[model samples]
Target: MADEETKAELREQFTEAFEGADYPVSNPMDLVPALPDGPGTRFEAGDVSFTAMELSTKLSDIQDFPYDDVETLVDDLIVGLDEKDML
Candidate 1:
């Protein structure tokens, strides 16, 4: 399990890295590209584009993990969105 401090640090790092890129429109159906051999989503939002790899990497690193649950999480999110008519 990851401690709170480590998680916070990772979150900060991830936000910093992604803040430099464009974000995708708030579309639930948007299909973001995956990072190379990494667990992340890349998309363009307005004038800012971002890669979510940093967040994945940070979380994995803090947990000392090599695998991520991103796919599962995304699937769950999609299901939830669909149920709520957000997708």
Candidate 2:
């Protein structure tokens, strides 16, 4: 499991990257344009790393569509990751 600081770093990275996405995104693809490297955008912390596509796959079941903002999406993402022991 990731330590608190590592998780915080990952969360910060996620927010910064995802914040550039166009809001009210109806699907995962809607976030690609904002990704620095598209679906290949990578997030890393501690010993963990995941590309946008990988994260999308891992969190698919927990993610709700049509996100209005990055925070809510990040909130769900963090929860999903936590539940899955990905963070």
Candidate 3:
């Protein structure tokens, strides 16, 4: 399990990157454009690192589309990472 500090750092990174998406995104592809390096954007903390593409594909089932805001989307992403033992 990731420590609180590590998780917090990861969350910050995710929020900063993902917050650029136009809200109310209806699908995973909507997030790709918001990424700094598109799908290649990589997020890392401790021993965990994954590209935006990997996050989208690997956690697809955990993601609920039509996200109303960045906060909710980021929350789900972090929760998915935790549930998958990746954070």
Itemize residue pairs with steric clashes in candidate 1.
21-49, 22-48, 22-49, 23-45, 23-48, 24-45
Q: How close is candidate 1 to the true structure, as a TM-score?
A: 0.31
Clashes of 1: 6
lDDT (tens digit, per residue) of candidate 3 on 12-67: 99899989898889998988888899999999988889999999988999999989
The lDDT of model 2 is 0.91
Q: Please report how far candidate 1 places residue 39 from its true position, in Å.
A: 11
| Residue 10 in model 1: lDDT | 40
**Window of ten residues with lowest summed lDDT in model 1:** 25-34
**TM-score, one value per model:** 0.31, 0.94, 0.95
**Local accuracy of candidate 2 as per-residue lDDT tens digits, 28-60:** 999999999999999998988899999999999
Q: What are the per-residue Cα lDDT tens digits for candidate 1 across 1-87?
A: 334454344444434433332244232122223233233454333233334543333333233222133433343433332344322
lDDT for 53 (candidate 1):
45
* Stretch of 10 with least lDDT, candidate 2: 1-10
Among these predictions, the greatest TM-score belongs to: 3
Query: What is the alpha-carbon lDDT for the whole of candidate 3?
Result: 0.90
